[model samples]
Target chain A: MKILGAIIIIAASTWAGFEWAKKLSERPKQLRQLKVALQSLEAEIVYGLTPLGQACIHLAEQLPKPLAWFFETVNKKLEEGSSSAQEAWDSSLNEIWKFTAFRQGEMEVMRQLGATIGKHDRDHQQKQLRLALIHLEREEGEAKEEQVKYEKMIKSLGFLAGILLVILLI
Target chain B: MKEILDVLPDTIRRVIEQMDTDIKKGIEEIRIRILRPLEIIVDGKSIIPDSDGGKHVITPQESGQLLNKLSQYSLYALEEELKRGYITIQGGHRVGLAGKVITEKGQVKAIKHIASFNIRVAKQKVGIADRFVPYLYDGKWLNTILIGPPQTGKTTLLRDLARIISTGDIARKLPSFKVGIVDERSEIAGCVNGVPQHHLGDRIDVLDACPKAEGMMMMIRSMSPDVLVVDEIGRKEDSEAILEAVNAGIQIIMTMHGNTMEDLFRRPSIRPLLDMGVFDRMIELTRANGPGTINRIRNQHGKEVYCKKVI
Candidate 1:
């Protein structure tokens, strides 16, 4: 029974470590997806001249989950007709941020983007989108660096900590 | 009309909605200005709705919200419209904007801080041109020019004429003609996303919001329309393009802002077209007996063909 408890405890810690490592890895990938989404948004606004609400719905359909859910929620809020574009965008971002691996810096970048997304002309909108892309690129680089530096360490630390706990308990 | 109401702020929309159906039906324009009472034009008269003993004065926030809704929260898509100082919403309703002008090196770049909006309601009166069809169409549709002042329903007449020509009136013994409309201001067809909201029939094609001169030539080359319909042509390039279309054996129906035949001759840009007799019929319209009242119809030689009898 004691051996079984040790095995279960180690397994739990290792699983928790893997989950953390996965999140660390996901940050960079999610940031890249966000950049692609913003690029598509720029194309839609500049070339297609699609309205922002419509563009969000389009992105929702084209993108993968979490991001898709984010855009879909934004579109729903916009279609509700009560909230402004910025309000819809910010609210959706807040709701989806908990589900994402995005940090506060990335959140701040997106919030800034929300403020001007549909307010300006094409040239100004394009500039604002590009600015957000630059900030996201910086965050993505940091995420990648953290993932490389800590992912393996965290995985090993989980096993090591579990062994230490087992020793102390025994 | 619903589209127009959707863009208005909540309070004004509610008041307008509560108005009598007669006033609602006759509504032509809804004018909103910052710090001013909301005014609606019905048959060329402005009527401010009574709002519980206090007039519903338009606030700056309301105007901002109006602009936001009109743009569909995407002002980036309205780059050209901001420069043009007007926006054509869905259902062909036009909102004229007045604001601080942003200029770049002597050129008007765009309108910013928009504080005034004039929402012109486009009501398509189908069959308003039926009586005139017998006069305007002979063996082939004539190169006709509808002359009128602003708010005299020239576009309404032209829209009906396009529908009639494109659909073909069996009762009137008129066969459907291949009609192409170069709707420069998006007025005649009230097109939304290049598709006309008006009932212009299946045999018609519209070049929405294209400049008159270039669009005329484009229509002739691509659409091969039997009759080309254009609105508000007074520009120099418009006359040149009309001459080109005429030489290409295409019948052109167009409108100009003028009260009388003298108004046509007064403009140097239109003088050459008049001298060449480019227009087969010049129909003058006036609001004297309510909008769309045909004052007189003159042949190419300036002889009266049909005149409204003063009763």
Candidate 2:
């Protein structure tokens, strides 16, 4: 029984560490994909001149799961006639961040981007989009560096901490 | 009615929705003004909402919210419509806005701080043109002009006439003709994403929100419509295009803002066309028995061929 318990604890700790490391590693790629999604969204706004609610819904169809849910929720709130564009965007972003690996500073850029979106002409909207793209791209680079620097450390730390706990308990 | 109220901000909609069923059914327009009581017009009479001996006034905040809702929270997307001073919403309803006008080099730049809105409810009266279509049709389609003053049912009549000509009523055995409408204001077709809300029939093609003159010529070249229809032709270019359409052998049916034949004669843009006998039949509408009331129809000789007494 003691040997079986030891094996189970080690296996669970290793799995948890690997999962954390994997999530950390995926953050940079997710941010980059989000930047691409936003670039296409800008195309829809500038070239197609589609309404904001409609543009968001269209983007939701093409983006990945978390970002898709983000846009889909914004579209729903906009169509409901209850909230303004900024409000809908801000709330949706807040709700979706938990599902994503987006950091707080990255989220601040999105909140600022929401303030000017759909409020001005095509030129102004495109300007806002470009600004957002710049911020996101910069953040994506930082996330990549952070992932490379700390992902392995997180995985190893989890394993070491579990081992320490098991040794202490024993 | 439901669509109009749905688009309205909650404060004003609540008052309009509580109106009597008869008033709601016949409601023509709902006007909203900042810091002013909500008012609706039924048949031509204005009804202001009052509760407990106090009028239900709209606040500035409510007006802003209403504007946002009407624009669907994206004012940038509706820039062109805003330039035209109105936005066409779902259900073919039009909400006209008025406010401070910003100009640049003697041209209107944009309207800012929209302080008032007039929501005109659209009701499509199908087959409303049945009584008058026969008079306009005499074997070959006549180049007809419907003359009516503001708030008259000129647009409504024109819309129905287009539908009937395009669909060809089976009961009346009227053959469908390929019809093209130059809906300059997007009012006739009430198009949402280029899809018409009203049934203009399968044989109809609409150039929604295109300028009348340009649209008329474009329709002629591309659509090759058997009958070309337009609303409110009063520009010099419009006359030039109409002359071109007439010479191209396409029949024309159009409306202009006028109370009588005299109004058409005095209007500078259309006066020359009238003198040139471009219009074969001139139909005058009045509010005598309500909108779309045909007061008289005249021939090219300016003789009244049909009058209200005969009808």
Candidate 3:
């Protein structure tokens, strides 16, 4: 047999070995941080909007790119001077809220997830939290699913590469 | 009649006229260049190759491509036979085509769409299979696949093997063995009916234009000869039939398109056959810087078991 043929076999084996190892290495703790962040976002939406989601919005504002450009566009359209928070909310979220979605869509839908706590809708918030828990499971599978996709991609590449190696060696 | 058709430079009108009067519908002519030891003509143009090697630069035109299109002649696959150096197309009718080798990753898949080729009319020579009588009998008829890429003389080899195995011997005045040939493309015995137009010696019976898969099944039940010789087994279906023949203790001689034995092993389509260990011998051919000719034949171990001079 040609040397190239031998190389192809070796390359295929190595790739298979790597994929086998990757599947064995992932831990549940490494995924916890992202899960926590997703839950916090869920809480804000379910309740009367938490300080965390508001903080995220502020960060999105300071992002200095899409948020900054969008804020600038709306600020210029405003009738008079207003504080940055109101300015940011009115210009950024207000413009977005007018769309069919933000006003009467997901927010209106999420309103039933929580119980009314001192004028806040508790049933809307609770339902939102329940859905968030379900969504967390969905997010967990994303990583594992991605790993599977990666494994397949490796196998396909390895197959072709192995064949080429065989040809080159021969 | 073929000679009369050969004389006129067949134009579109002549083509229509020929069609009206039982004329063949493919290409009317093909310009080919010969490296040596042969002669050719197409549409009044002398077909010869550039001296840079056996590269016959044919002009790509409608009329130029016409003569090699397809034919109604007996199952000789005239053009394919010619390309493999089986017979020479002296004048009038010429065959033409060349196939692109489909390679996957790097392994050869199969040859497809013969772009350039030749058609050589088959002429029978009466007795030629007598030489291999000793090698075939006493349970000597080994199931074989006469493998070689396009134009490596698979059909010619097949015709000879069929002739030898069918008839016991032609030279020593030995008893002719009753042989059945499945000429799937009519390229083998050039059978017009049950009769063979080409020389397959006296011992061979031919099945023409029948698919190898169907022919094998048909021949097994009907002919039941000591040996089964066929040409160009390509797909998995064809292999299955050959396998069935092999499993039934019926000896088979077939061919495939592969230049070397190593190449034969790498082919996914043919790989199963190799793994199954059916083919006793694999004949490989390569055009040796000249016209078409066999390079050598290798045993199952890929050793040069047999070599022949182009006589």
Say which candidate scores most in DockQ. Answer: 1
Residue-wise C-alpha lDDT for candidate 3, range B1-311, written one tens digit per residue: 35424422233224324233322323234333322221233322444323334433343332222322232111112323433322223231324445555466886543344444444433333333334344334446766666667765567667776766655444644455566677776677765434676556666666766778899888888988657777877788888888888887788888777777787778777788888777777666666643236566566666666677756
Q: Each model's TM-score, in the order given?
A: 0.96, 0.91, 0.42
TM-score of chain B of 2: 0.93
lDDT of 1 at B190: 85
Model 1 over residues B181-256: C-alpha lDDT tens digits? 9988888898888889988899999998899999999998999999999999999999999999999999999999
Report the error of model 3 at residue B153, Å.
1.7
All candidates: CA RMSD (Å): 1.6, 2.8, 30.8
Q: Against the true two-chain complex, what DockQ does each candidate achieve? A: 0.83, 0.58, 0.00
Instruction: Specify the poorest-scoring 10-residue window by lDDT in model 2 chain B.
Output: B10-19
How do the residues B124-204 of candidate 2 rate in per-residue lDDT, one tens digit apiece? 999888888778887768999999997678999999999988988677677899999999998999987788888789998
Candidate 1 Cα misplacement greater than 4 A, ranges? none
Off-target runs (Cα >4 Å) in candidate 3 are: A1-170, B1-119, B123-139, B170-175, B289-292, B307-311
Tell me the tens digit of each residue's lDDT in model 3 across A58-96: 334554343334334433432122222223334454454
Error of 3 at B67 (Å): 11
Give the top-scoring candidate (TM-score).
1
Q: Give the alpha carbon lDDT tens digit for every residue of A1-170 in model 1.
A: 99999999899888888888999999999999999999999999999999988999999998989999999999898787744789989999999989988899999999999999899889999999999999999999999999999999999988888888999999
